[model samples]
Target: MHTKDDWITTPVTADLLRGALDVERTEHGVLPHRLPARARAQCSDGQLAMAEAQPSGVRLVFRTRATVVELDALPTKRVYVGAPPRPDGVYDLLVDGRPAGRGSVPGGNTLTIDMTTGSFETRPGPPGTLRFDGLPVGTKDVEIWLPHNETTELVALRTDAPVEPAPDPGRRVWLHHGSSISHGSDAESPTTTWPALAASLGGVELINLGLGGSALLDPFTARALRDTPADLISLKIGINLVNADLMRMRAFTPAVHGFLDTIREGHPATPLLVVSPILCPIHEDTPGPSAPDFSGLGEGRLRFRAMGDPAERASGKLTLNAIREELARIVAQRAADDPNIHYADGRDLYGAADFAELPLPDQLHPDAAAHRRIGERFAELAFGAGGVFADSAPPA
Candidate 1:
């Protein structure tokens, strides 16, 4: 015998007893083809029903059957090169068909995109997906131009939902810098980038400045980080520098210090985490192109060589071990003055032991499965219990 208010107020109550469980279910048949009408309808009338959008740049969203809203991120314009003569492929970007940007994928699988001018050049991108972002807030029509070899397929589009202005300021920001592995290379979607994954898990807003080939201790990048706003910061170094053979011990040592010193200029007391490169065979003790072979025929058929002898690393090259040793020494020296600074060996997130079990298919970038493993490990080590980062709190 309970009053109406009593029944409603019960904290741990059974809905069945109250007859409030009028469960209703409906199964909508899947629709095949690009730009499903329903999705397009949601985008019509210059209205969008989405979580977020960028008024002036490309916004990427990743979804899968397991998780409908899998991941999303605004594309970072910074690009990098892996090998020379970068591959040549179609550069397709359409904003109502006026040509927002254009570039061809070169041979090295490199990418160079100019955000300000809306231009791009990169090697052939991974296949089987298409995305567009940066539409004017009230776009009603969209025309696309495809690469010579590609066909434009409208996969999906949605107008962003209006965002309510927040009354309170957001939490302290965390800025991170890293390589392709951090740039979501081979990640199932743009949002699955390890940094993004970790950020979501940590509940911190992020400024991911992961430039693929460009992470090699560049002065400009250091300057950029120094100028940016951040309360917590991190730099995932080593692999790219090793693979690119960008500098030797003579220059590498100073460059590392310079990068850190530059960031400290802006964040004198902010917590900074320096992450070593994760386990990458091609660049781990072994010089790059660790193993290479040729098969098939024609110009596009011959594969480049890689994976040389690990013992040869003694010849003044940047290897993972070399970077690790140097980073440890550098951090130890700096830690004396900068107590807020921290160091995290990338292997702590994904180590040689894990590599033995889950080798990167390309011997460079981790595949999708590896990305998940790395993401989980990163979330645990960099953002888990007793971790240095305190910016991210579990969502309420």
Candidate 2:
């Protein structure tokens, strides 16, 4: 058991956090928000609200000389009505940009969701503590990456020594938005998410707006992107739009245009890359709303199956292939007028051949290994020499 006999308790302040746009003070502690309160208030979907608050790319970053560190947190774990119990959320610690330690705060709140009825119930619980020991002596950059999927409210920070907000590394800020894949779904930890890894590889500071099941090209999200400061930007689209069956081509075309227009209003010359969906066999040609496959629920496994027919495509119903083609065309057309805009086929990140080796376990999102591959591919394609985003990239 960890105690605070000789420890110094420090309040977790907004200045100590990175990649969070805003934060809400909660009874347990501080709840980080990827989307600002204004954007959150414009929407009513509980799913989107929850996704934006999960802290996919957020972390507690500071400089400290402490060898022992403890973080008190309240993590809200999501529990599906029929799925297996989730493991405790993992908090990854990095010292001077190297992985130093990892820990998890056990026993927090639970949010139970019934997919069949689209209903959810939240049960409150007390905060738990995470302790990490054996840090290198002397002042070192410390980063405690919050859990990617769990909604965590930080209560307090206790260390053997004092800490200060870390100095900015002067890396170019890269703001990205996407679906669960970018939100770190199926990722091993927060930092291993595709966007996070890609940001590290690209030598960019990341502000991820990747909300799971909520990247429907909302006006507020576009406005958030418009207002956020970024040297580079990207959007991994199509997956959530198709899986949600949210819109047809009629709505998608203008939605894409409007989203770009809004962001360009603030960053007209910024390098903006529009990425289409990666390979998903079920949704490659078939349209969605995807349905849950409860056949394996008894074995604590759940899967997804596309419910829309291929015939729907003739009627402009969205599919991965259609979305990819349309996105490519849109980017090409926009690039003629906006030289900084570009396009990348998501297939380049994870396609059929790659899928053969690293399959999507739930028939939708990529697993941890696939996330690495996607991140690596994205880094090479977006930040490598001559890549679209390489003009101002950090020295390799």
Candidate 3:
């Protein structure tokens, strides 16, 4: 057994983080941010702040010969006011881009939320350690993907051997923006999120900006997307807009156009695919500002309900169906002038049939199995012959 003296400690820094747009030096260590500071400053919503800091697609990448690696972090876990404690967020380890193992840290701060009232409170606690042992005993690239749901402040990284930044393999970079489904909610692990799995299959580098409950087409978010460097880009729109009930049809159309215009400012000709939301039964025809269905709260569980009336959609309120139609129209019209813009029906990703085979456990987010199905379907649709990203894969 190795003693404490056998480990070499390395300070966590921005240079080692992948899939993060920016990093903040925290009191304890470093916190990764998907949206940069400027964008973060524009929004005061606690939901978006928590989602971006949770590190859904962020991971530490390094080359080391160590058989054991440990990361120290201060993770802020969420607790629903009346639900059973959530399973600890999972950390996925990959060696040479393949799954090596998974683990989780315990005893961190808890943020208790009252979904019914949109209220929350946080209680602080000490940091914890996450360790992975028995890695292959030679030089290799190792990635420690942070938990996709927990807000983590990376404190330290330690390995038995010295570490260096992993050399880039010159893969095409795919940047994606979307809502919770794309943020790995209910997914088994960080790498199993649809975008991550699709990125693995497509052999591209991933930069996911999939903020949960926060993919509304905010101008700052669009500007961040515009400035971020990427070879190919994708936006999964609709679900969040409907869920938040943030805008009416009059605003949604102009907002969509403005978002696209911002991104095109930086990436004029990049293959930009706009994806509509997957089939969500409750919101398919109904408009929403979805509400918490606490019926399951007695069982220590929680579910969501779309609260908008179907009739309201005729008043210009957004529904998944309406959003999809508008998105298709917008992309088609944009494609006429800018041939690089494309559209994909998200129902193609998690449609009615797939929903039957592997249903979304919650009315909102896809479960782990559904995430896999969506990921595989996305790989086939987006990277297969003649797909928008068909030519993006690195040469075999």
Candidate 4:
């Protein structure tokens, strides 16, 4: 039996955390980072830095008999000057592997980004508390999933009863890397992200390294994957490379091989699945360095347009079609010796047909319903019988 005054404060530590590659002890609290310090030190890209700290799939898990639990966190919210106010990031609570509660922390730092100018400003704000009351009233597993889009710095955790770090759930860890789609771009909540949903359905611990605009085949990202412990791994490539106009087919081919080689150095036999980009009609045939189409901004809408010259395709500029073909060839060549390596066509996950039914609201990121569809399809394709990762290990 617990009383109102029996609040126990638990120190936030790596032992009680999951899905993050590193945890930084800030002066105010602990900040979970998807990219480790060494990797971050190698790149000074601000966009990548921001995306990695968003904690797409990170969560704190513990066991306690407390009926009430409170978490103190400072979440950095992104605001576009002319765009509509983005919804507050939602924190999801799971008890005994079941959805128990959900709430959003308010009053945090604000990052005002001006996409038109490619500039931004930050304003500091105060930390807020998230509370969950009236649990089942006995010792049980509790997982608090942080917001997928907002940058969160955890301050403290309190409960009516003392909490203990939850033991490993015996699930194989799935390390996944991709672009903003995998980073939960338009996801409604943390747990509702495609990766989160798929991990839940597949019963695996998730380490999502989906660094929005930064999944550009950087060696450091590959090295980060190499160092992480994972029984299953996936790389979602193509769209980011095309949208950023980062590389052509010539450089792209070698970069893909190098990325896989780096990971193979550590986990030669690990089940690795390479997934191409989900369909984005605008970039499917056209090359890009995508540009913002802010014509709709006045109406609180934002959109994108491919700015790459179609003529550049003759000079080897990359498009989704080109990428898919090249990736299939690369995987086929490697599969001869690397039996664990597999390729999943992105179209299989979301094709032109899917777009017709559930169109991308902003002509880019998927909406909440689309996220659910992708998650369900992924579970069936990648985790079901005869799937690439089907025999890796039984679900936890």
Candidate 5:
């Protein structure tokens, strides 16, 4: 029941906001995963704190314009929401009181809504906020009906002013794709999701295609990216493949190529970055159930089993290391001709060193501090020094 003039602001404080990395014990003493020094300065201690800090549950937030004023041109609208494990739900979007799009937020970390179907033809100021930007655009009135026990908070709403019409013109867009890890799992806020963070840091318009539990290199996903508009593009793969044991080396290599090939059909020269997964122990050198034993689930206290038998490790199955090696080979071969294409191992953003210092709270997904670490690293590497997007970026 808030309005446009309310101006939601995340408070800041000097006290330390407990981070996800702070929840567990590690081999190298208690790891210290902290927010980027800059983030600490912006968010109040209370704002930095998580509402449901448990490791096994999912938390999401859905938001969009409450009213739209000017509608000279179709503005790019976005809705930001946080994530948790096993997030499954349906989000319906509407515009001008008509159904425009429909989508699902399967369980994972991050969820985003982008509204970009038809041109804007309404008046300005803020006409009842166009509904649901996190789902595919074309939706009219935004309404999200989620399953019970799933927690969500409407965080923020954003849109770009209509651009002046031009005869010979096109918009610069960024198309990014990745797995649940990229989807912002366990991150504290909508703006903190690594892709969102990177987009904010990079100062580029983005279509976040990060699907939780759905980055399995599906042909549908590749086609989605292929048809989407983008000036720059990136695809983060590997982690999900390893954890799910979806494909072997032979199938993986070809799948990666095919996925890229599909995208290339649409954005032939756009800068494309292929990112591998970040550090994850359960799938680092090991296959996964990635499952947790929540035998002791109390009212709000959920605990999980962290360690598994060594025999499981020796099974010679898919692991993060294995995925990284395969990705390297793929990029090495592809980069020769596609100079615009690039590769980034997930670890470079948050690898063994970071994990050694701050093991993931549940040994799978990163905590808030880890998210900050990943964000800072991504800002440095992906956006380059002195990037402006994440610096002055608004809340998601």
Candidate 6:
């Protein structure tokens, strides 16, 4: 085994990365992207662009005999106007497939966003280092999971031993798409996100496409999913659509169909699970265009509320209830010929009772505790015995 005295610096390369659909060599370093260049080119929406750039499920995987490792990264952390400052992004390290340590860089850039004014400002900051030491002897596979909500630039990697690309674990890959709730929301760290937790429990590799504020059933996103290689797949829909108020029932139904159809074209026999929105009481019966409530911002607290009238539902505006029904119907009707397709109501994971105990802190995203509960429940319902995803292998 290499000793601490023999530390060596290695350049970050694509071969040692996973979960990112694409990677770009930036002037400062390599920037991992959740969406491919082609897909990114198709949309100029700032939200989608920023969301995809966040490395929610992206990780650096390698094998080495090093007992110490360090990664230098430049992370751009977001700060909402009239909201409390966010904690530094965390980097979780796993040794031989188990949690070994967690660390965060001290400095990076800052993005201040004013929701009410639709304005943002970027400020520069310094790069910081994340270190993990006292690894066990002999060669071992190491994974450094990037922060789910941070846009990180890979600056450099240093270790006590020479590193090589990690051998594949031979586990099935599960690709998931959703909103901020699935995008790490209030999760403590990248690996603790519900999708990440469920992936660990299900014994499957995860490719998270949970773009915050951007899961609007965009065609480019569907195409990205269609082209990615995956043995199991799922989509958590509804929340973002309602909050964005980007469409009515007329456009939503067709958009959902188109998204599913595009995915099926590439994954004809893959087990595809359709998940509706979790129980968001504020939007259960009411329509949205959710608005920020900064009443407590002076005290460093932030919250949200549905702005649309409940009566608007009568005019074909979408609501949580409407989405759930449509998703169920679509899956049932399609299952007649495509038995591989399945539906799991999001409420099954976080229902009314669960909310009574652990409410969403922001009235939108789940809190850290709620994230854990949802992750565990998802693993049990979708990946447990007789569940829709029980058998991740493609249909025979």
C-alpha root-mean-square deviation, candidate 4 = 1.8
Model 5 error, position 175 (Å): 1.8
Candidate 6 residue runs with Cα over 4 Å from true position: 1-5, 392-396
Task: Give the Cα lDDT of each candidate.
Answer: 0.52, 0.92, 0.91, 0.93, 0.50, 0.92
In candidate 3, what are the lDDT values of residues 237-344, reduced to their tens digit?
Answer: 999999989999999999999999999999998889999999999999999998877888868666788999999988999999999999999999998899888899
Every model's TM-score = 0.58, 0.97, 0.97, 0.98, 0.55, 0.97
lDDT of 6 at 200: 95
Error of 4 at 18 (Å): 0.5
lDDT of 5 by residue, 1-396 (tens): 335455333211111111111222322112121222232344343212221122111112123333332111111122222212333333333343234454443223332321123122322222122233343333122322211112222222333221111121133455667765665666654445666566556665445555555567877567667766666777889776765566666677788999999989987876777888887766666665354434332222233332334355355455677778878888889878876777788888888789988777666677778878887777677667532122322222
* Selected candidate, larger lDDT, 1 vs 5: 1
Off by over 4 Å in 3: 392-396
Q: Which residue pairs clash in candidate 4?
A: none
Encode model 2's per-residue lDDT on 169-205: one tens digit a residue. 9989999999999999989999999999999999889
Clashes per candidate, residues 3 or more apart or on different chains: 23, 0, 0, 0, 49, 0
Clash tally for model 1: 23
Question: lDDT tens digits, residues 1-396, model 4?
Answer: 666566899999998899999999997799999999999999999999999999899999999988899999999999997888888999999999999999999999999999889899999999999999989978999999999999999999999989999988898889999999999999888899999999988888899999999999999999999999999999999999998999989999999999999999999999999999999999988999988898888787888999987788899999998999999999999999998899999888888999999999888889999999998899888988878878654432
